[model samples]
Target: MNQHPAARLTWYAVLLVLALVFSFPLYWMAVNSLQPLFTGMTWFPVRPTLENFRLAFTLQPYWTFFRNSCILALISVGIPIFTSFFSAFAFARLKAKLKGVLFMVILSTMMIPPTVTQIPQLVLFKQYGLLGTYWPWIIGGLGGSPFIIFLYRQFFMNVPKELDEAARIDGCSTFAIIWRIYMPISIPVVATAAIMSFNTSWGGDYLAPFMFLQERQYPLSTQLMQVGYILPSSPNVDLFQVKQAALLIFVLPILIVFLFGQRFLISGIMTGAIKS
Candidate 1:
């Protein structure tokens, strides 16, 4: 059937507006980061300079924070992807009598407001002496995240049973099946989980590192809050430029990753939404 020209034009117009709405902030940030310190707020920076970017690296131990953020984000994203994949595969393919009940119990955790458990989690981490280190964040990611597992399980279940049966007939073990066949076909869901996990860890401000670490060990999110909000009392403070630069440093990595992975991210999200 032929498409309606007016409807297509309307859809394109709507998308263009939506794109501008989403992109405006990023555009402003990029523009602002290049502006002179005392230029004030303007639509366009009259004198663009690399001074903000330069000051960002020079003023704070920004590189250290960047490295720490990368480590934290990697562990937080990677652990969930690995653990959730196997757990999801089990839920999708295994035939244990307790499977349904156990899955329900796992899913139930998602219903509980995360805030309700924050204090308890902090207390537990402190008691175990895991605070002030990466352990807290790492442990959180190591668990089979309920939402990710649910998404993966749905995708895995959609794969033909014949694939598993054929692999088993050839004497392939569960591990072999997962590694050799199922995983190969599940790239989109994997990408989805990775993107979600990475974004969550990269942007998360309230938990994980917050309760578990001190100022010295704070990740980019916490550090950004510190540097951005805390203005110097002294007149000598290059407060405006320094903070702008710091914020730019903190945001650049995530922005770069998103730009590079956007296509895969979109594909993954769409494909993962398809129920088996």
Candidate 2:
């Protein structure tokens, strides 16, 4: 497994370049967000100010949008962890007819583009009278994520079966085994799924919330569009700086989540890959 010192140095250099390239947009946004209104494009701000952020809040109910986003993210995080863990446990531990077939059917859903189902889902939610509320997003999360279930099942499958057997011998029920044994050891996958769900609900989604929720109920992702262009009170405001400030605030949570949970996310993903 030994490599030349020069090879290692070259690999490191390539990675550093790629990292900077990938992060450039974020760097640009942060730099622009601090710049004063009407400031032209510059690599670095000549004189930074918080006026853009102030305008972003003044033009929109920034805190309300943030609250909505947090509510959705929390719901998205909790529901999937509850549903996917148990669903994955059943697939991983139990014996059932058509088990493999059922699991594959669930996994197949992942391949279907969300756009294909949006119209039908929209109609369904509208019929249920959930269109203007958070219920649409909440109900959507009730159906546990296929990817997370697969990840959990893979990680569970890798666990020694002897643990389950021993637990059963001690009068542990199926639920008890899952709760007491597997759940404790599944922290990495749990954190991974939670953060993924949070990110998707918090920022990765725009169309669904925009379509389903009321204007006041719109989360930051969808509201950002409104903030960017439709400054009702300040039609003459510098929109570029306002948008940059809004975007920076919007993206900060996702950035922080990734920075902290990336280790668990990688571990969870790799653990699943080892077996399947």
RMSD in Å for all candidates: 2.2, 1.7
List runs of model 2 lying over 4 Å from the truth: 227-238
Lowest summed lDDT across 10 adjacent residues in model 1 is found at: 229-238
Q: How many residue pairs clash in each candidate?
A: 0, 0
User: What do the candidate models score in CA lDDT, each in turn?
Assistant: 0.79, 0.87
Candidate 1 lDDT by residue in tens digits, 183-211: 88888778877877777788775465667
lDDT of 2 at 173: 96
- After the best TM-score superposition of candidate 2, give how far the Cα of residue 255 lies from its true spot, in angstroms: 1.0
For candidate 2, what's the RMSD? 1.7
